[model samples]
Target: MRIAVGEDDVLLREGVTRVLLGAGLDVVASTGDATKLLAMTLAFRPDVVVVDVRMPPHHGDDGLRTAIEVRKRLPATGVVLLTQYCEPEFAIDLIGDRPQGVGYLLKERVGDVDDFAAAVKRVAHGGSALDPEVVTRMLRPRTVPSELADLTDRERSVLACMAEGLSNRGIARALLISEAAVEKHVTATFRKLGLAQLTDGHRRVQAVLRYLAAQGP
Candidate 1:
């Protein structure tokens, strides 16, 4: 697949490109600036774009913002935001919309070349890929209300997968259930959590984050 990369760190950018090339994926363009990232994305029309959360100038949410723009402008192109550390809030925002063709993974994860390549392929094929650490960090103990506490073990399991950025089909595959059954569980879980049926993508992520934050760090 044709791919583009956005990372300010020169070495990391090169490393990522090498890894992708080694996996037999074509690297169409790589840039150190977020502005160039957007430009290259439009010009190269890559099937997938890998970006770092921190980039030149703002060095905060530039990459995340670029990903959002890409989704709006190039709906068919997939995006994967890489980070040096686990930031659930940033991940939530980066992937809140278009959850299907998006991913968030730690830079350290690149060491596992196989897994990293799998994540890239998954996002390119319109699937979500989230770091395991991201899920664990978002589900830590918190002061949940008695209402939310009523969720069954299965429901909680479903929620955990949801928070990990899994789609209904993904949750079903992970849980070894049919996609229809996954939807049922998801709908039931949402109702138990008092969430609206409209909740999807980032909104669903925010809801999960609020629940986790209420439980405390």
Candidate 2:
């Protein structure tokens, strides 16, 4: 997939770019300037854009603001907003008005090349990939949703893994269960969450959204 990276840290940016290149993804552009990042994305229209949560010209939420703008202006271009901090609220902002083709992951996730590649592919192909840590924060300090109460604990676990963008096989490995069992749990979780309206794959993204709503501020 073609990707553009926006990170203020030079070492991290170069390292990430090299890693992505080694992984065979096209790195169309890399920049630390927040506005330049936005401009490059608009111009190149890469398949995916990876942005740090903080960046030049403010460093508070410039990267985030750019990611949100990309979603609004270029909805088809996938965006992955990376953060060193676990801020579920920022993730919520990305998913607030529209969740399609968007991802929110922790910067540390980049250390795992396999996971990083998976996240890039998932988002580029129009899937949501929220960090598990972010989802955990979202779930804490919030009352469980009525719909979620219908899910068994195992099913809830399955759904949480789903929010992390894990495939059935991945979830199976994580939970030390058979892939078939994971599939069953996924279906049951979808049904219990009243997410039957979504198609097979879409149900996964919608499931994350449901979880978000259940734990949203």
The 0-to-1 C-alpha lDDT of every candidate, in the order given, reads 0.80, 0.84
Give lDDT tens digits, candidate 1, residues 1-217. Answer: 9999999989989999999999999999999998899999999999999998767655556777788889889999999988886867666666665578988898776678888988999999999899899988778775545645877656666777877878887786565445776778777876666676554665567657755654565
Error of 2 at 142 (Å): 3.0
Off by over 4 Å in 1: 144-217
Looking at candidate 1, what is the lDDT of residue 45? 91
Per-candidate total of colliding backbone pairs: 3, 0
Q: Work out candidate 1's RMSD over C-alphas.
A: 12.4
- In model 2, what is the error at residue 37, expressed in angstroms? 0.4
* The candidate that achieves the highest lDDT relative to the unseen native structure: 2
Question: RMSD per prediction, one decimal?
Answer: 12.4, 15.1
